[model samples]
Target: MFYDVRRIESYSLKISIENGRVEKVKFDESRGKAFRVLKNGFWGYFVGDVDDREGIYLAEKNAIGKGDVNVLNVSSGGKFTLKPKEDFRDVSVEEKVEFLRDVEKNLKGDKIVSTSVTYFENVRRFSYYDSNGNEVFYEIPRIGLIVSAVAKDRTLQFYSKRIMKPAGLEALKGAYDIANEVVDVVTKLVNANAPPSGDMNVVADSSLAGVFIHEAFGHAVEGDHVLQGASVLANKLGQKVADESVNIYDDPTLREFGFYPFDDEGVKAEKRTIVENGILKDFLHSRETALKFNSKAGNSRAEGLKFPIVRMSNTYLDRGQYKFDELLEIAKDGVYLVGSRGGETNPATGYFQFNAQYGYLIEGGELTEMIRDVSLSGYTLEILKNIKIGCELEFDPGFCGKVDQLVPVSDGSPHILIKALVGGS
Candidate 1:
């Protein structure tokens, strides 16, 4: 048998604060060892927590007979570079904590009944090799700061707009913007009222619209789901999916949370268009799925130590021809939904549910009353076709969860004016 080896390691630190007291601090490191041994087109895989060279080799040899030895048909991978401005390895935990503490203190306000803040930092290093002599190596650092706020009512709440980014400590510097947004939303919620129910022309803020595209449309474009006959977009390539002004992309090549030199499968990632000028372009794919569907692998990925799966990195809508105010100017009576509290979707059924932190009634093309508990639910295909206009673009960062696994992702679009259906009690 011939074997190929890969090296993987992760360093992580987390600090949580609540009620002006230090809550918890966690530090850990993980090193993974894996061997790819091939015999007669069959692959024998072995993975463990040990890093000793001898242990890794022995584990590969010993596991040859335990599981199904099926060789994975993979694509050719080559050298690539994803440079970091500052590496997390050069920073200390105490330094990270001090920055987070400052954020907590800065956000403390009279209307802020309580505050909880969390800081997370991680660095991943890995290298992989193939029998074909292809090699890929990567070093990436990520940082996250999340602040949760409660108003005097205790029930009125919201979360920070800042999410983890694929950068170093410098990424955490401008977090006061997020903290201020959270404070504003929570305070408004304490005094806001529910929007009156009606058929409405709506403007979805960039962050909320980004979540709409990701949870509602992006997942529908993963090739695996299409192959499984579980996606609403299945077999819809070359057809119109939205307004001619709508152009959505999954571009890992762009600088965002999902950027990577190469996917976990060691394949070079590429920018892909899922929708262009209202037409369906293509679906995201891994090598196997791409082969099965006669397409290119768009670098759909998963975490290390696990086999790679089809996933989106930085999915976003391209900016449109209109500005945000212009969209509102066209709608005399409507509501504008802003920000997001995440959302849920069934890509197969095209059904989705998304909650906005707050909304404002627009009267005479001007912002008016504030509304609370705004949730939008509908079929993905139906609502997308109803998009009247697209606004300029912006990004909202967060973690995307799939099958209980969390991966960093960013979603955004400019404000979108839509004739949408929303419901709440």
Candidate 2:
């Protein structure tokens, strides 16, 4: 095993528009350095970064430490190349603002009293080096579009969604529709009634399905939590954990939100099956954690300048043969939940809570009435087992938070029929 020193420089533009007016514009540039040392067992780690070359050397020298050091022998070392459909560098900032303004304008509706649109683009360049005389350089471009709509009435409701991908200007092509969707949902909720809390089967739309995977399953598989003995999955390998129809994966090689050619540890990224047909196929692992279990899967990632830890990229459930209507056919007296605002998970306890932007009540297998203020809470294993059916796959982009840091991620599946224990918390 060998150690590598890597540096990354990122440039980003964040533009926000509210109520059909440009509210703020900001540009940010930052550089980060990381040192990868392989000496002791999996327990040894010391990482810190500074801007100057002198500080880089100081950080490297200080990276040395005692205890177990986990070293992974990667097949190759380099950065992944990104091909943008539309280059942000080739587009002017004026065009970006105009695009968002257009979206806000279209969001006007009787119930939608206010609308906000946010546009973000970033270029991340990586320079990598290793003790084995290897060096590489590459850049990845990312873009995101988010819109939020609020209903004005005696009762207030808000709806929002985010789009993330590797494309540039063309990425905003569907942003207009996102605004419309938010408006449509919020409009319904503005006059909708509260959902009756119960343990009913729910049909989660693609976005909410993504949240179910990210918050309910992704958090449960993080290797660090397992290493800290804080994960329910810590010692449950090769066990049956879900229904026979369920399978989940994390593949950064996918050109979606969480796509990365190489992980922060200079290891090439690949797809790994975390669960298959209710079986615990594997757990996400960093080099250190992988060594601890004598495994070879690589899922290590570092946020900006932090030390590498296990994280998921493009984490999602595989598609099933059933169509969405089939799920509706089964959830006749349940709820059709859509989109996600945010959620939380306790990997150690296997508990999760996710909030839905809006929902529609289903009666006798037909859409009935709109409902608001819906949140789902339950244990991860129980929910997974309760997944009776899922439609063909779909995807949604998002940012995942961990250890006080956020990283780009995407998750999705078709409408899933989960006999979830939901409530209005």
Candidate 3:
């Protein structure tokens, strides 16, 4: 029998503020243990409501079946902690409330009609052990604040910004700036017009470009999807799938929201270059998939007390030498899409549609009137070939959801000029 046990614990605090008043304050602490067993080559899992031996017994009972699930022999373990300076625990709740108030006041505007801000901080500790005698443990503290604002004049528009990092109060140093930017963007978006619709040159700002990379290309390279015949890139490994100017990487070592010293399965993090100079090189993997693909394993991850799955951490498109003006010049008569609301993609078909938070029209290679409710869409394989990567890669943090599980992640890219179909949503 092959089995693993996990003990996960967390402490978190959240405060919600609206229109400069505290709306809610919440604090929570939780802990749980889960067990996974492979009996007769079938995997089974059980979480909560049992002591260690009982949990293992139940898991093994469920795992008893005629099946074929094999895992590579990997003996890996470690202990680490990402300690945050000025821990949120040391900061009083009143002070946290006051901090939110100061940030709320930064959302200044005559046209602004509403504002809401939420603060969150969490400390997570995890322990893992397996029948093979491997053990691992780690602790990490994280914090974040989200601010949203709505404005109305000719049209109602909304905008939001968030700052999440693997730190404590110090992570919110730029909260005021984000608040101001949200107000400023939404204020202008109220008067913004719909974009011109067509297949044309489009320049995606870093945030939007990052979204495309994460949502379209990144998902296509997940090992499980590839193995399941659910990815377009599955058969394209070692071949050119993008322009020679492009390079894409998934690295969890960065100190972004997705940072982790090691994944849940005890595999140490490493930079995996999925695409290099246009060729598809590697796919993200868990140990199970790694054996099938003959690739290194590091991306096995999971929500607390959940079974590990293949996942991405900090994924980004490598920067090119082109500047913002150069990308604008390249897309002389198209929309300059900025930010991301959200998007959906079909990895099997490589088709994706994403909504840009807002954008501007480019005429004669210069920014013109603001445009709202813009969307970009295209086949991933084709779109990658059509992009001209720009300089100064930047990251935007958020949660990536799959199969009802969500994990913190960061996506990044420089500006990218591409030809795509753009329209109003």
Candidate 4:
């Protein structure tokens, strides 16, 4: 039997400013412990208040038997701490609220119906011990600022800017510039025409490309999805999945919002190249899934005491040779999609659809007119095969949800050119 104990200590603060006024300020602190026992092929888990001894007892008592499976050996253990330039705890709630309020002030315009600014920070401490003589501890801190502007004329238009990273309050130092950009984009979107609906070459900004990589391609390469036969990439390792310029990696070591020195499963966090030069290389893996796939374990993650599962960290498409202007020129007659509201993907079928918050028509290698209500839809493999990757890489931080669990993650890419179906209202 194998057993492990995990303790998570978390602190968070949030400030919301709406319409140039402080709307809400909240702070929370929580501590929890989870214990897991591996018996036969079954996992017995228990989560409760931060009492490690009790959690261990309960987890052992709950052990069950299925068949048998062996996990890859990962015995390295140590203590790691991330020292932020500025500690988030040192910044008072009032200061955070005031900063957001100032950012909100810069987002006001006559056509703007409402503006909201939110600042959030989280610090998490993780400690782990296992029966195999392994112990580890680490601390991670993250902060983010989100600014939203809604403009109303004949209809409503909204635009938002997000700045999230694995830093402290210093990450929000440039909040005003992002606020101004959001206001300008929303103002233009308020009067922009709907894009023409059809299939065409398209250029995606870094943010949209990030979401596309995360939702379209990333999930399909998850080992858990492959085990369940719910991924198109299952059984397709070493095959060509994208253009040779396409290189993708999920690196937990990167100092992005998804940075983690060690996974919850006591596995040392390391970078996994999921795709390299268009060939399917590897899948993200937890201990169990790693065992099943005869691979190494590292991608396992959890939120507080929730059960650990395979999850992506800082996933991104590697930068290519083409610059942003070069990509636009390559897509000479297509639309330039910018920013992502949200999107959905079916890992099994590789079908994906995502909305670009706003876009611009490209004419003669230049951005021509603003467009709104645009959605991009296509099969993941098809888009990847048609992709022309760009040189400037950028990352966007957010939360990823799977199996009812939410975890911080960062996804990124440079400008990418592709041909896909574009839908417009």
TM-score of each: 0.90, 0.93, 0.98, 0.97
| Models sorted by lDDT, best on top | 3, 4, 2, 1
lDDT of each: 0.77, 0.79, 0.91, 0.88
lDDT of 2 at 80: 62
lDDT of model 3 at position 29:
95
Query: For model 2, how does the per-residue alpha-carbon lDDT over 243-359 read when each residue is reduced to its tens digit?
Result: 888899888988789888877766777898899898987888887678777776568777777776788899888887677777788887889888887878788888888888778
In angstroms, what RMSD does candidate 1 have relative to the true structure? 3.2
lDDT of 2: 0.79
lDDT of 4: 0.88
Best by lDDT: 3
By TM-score, how accurate is candidate 4? 0.97
Could you give candidate 3's per-residue lDDT for residues 66-107 as a string of tens digits?
677777667788898988877999989999999899999988
Model 1 Cα lDDT, one tens digit per residue, 310-338:
88999998988777788889877889998
Q: lDDT, candidate 3, residue 143?
A: 93
TM-score attained by model 2: 0.93
Question: For all candidates, what are the clash counts?
Answer: 1, 4, 0, 0
Error of 1 at 32 (Å): 0.4
Q: Residue 305 error for model 3, in Å? A: 1.4
Find the number of clashing residue pairs for candidate 4.
0
Model 4: per-residue lDDT, tens digit, 143-199? 998889889986699888888988877788888899899888888888889898899
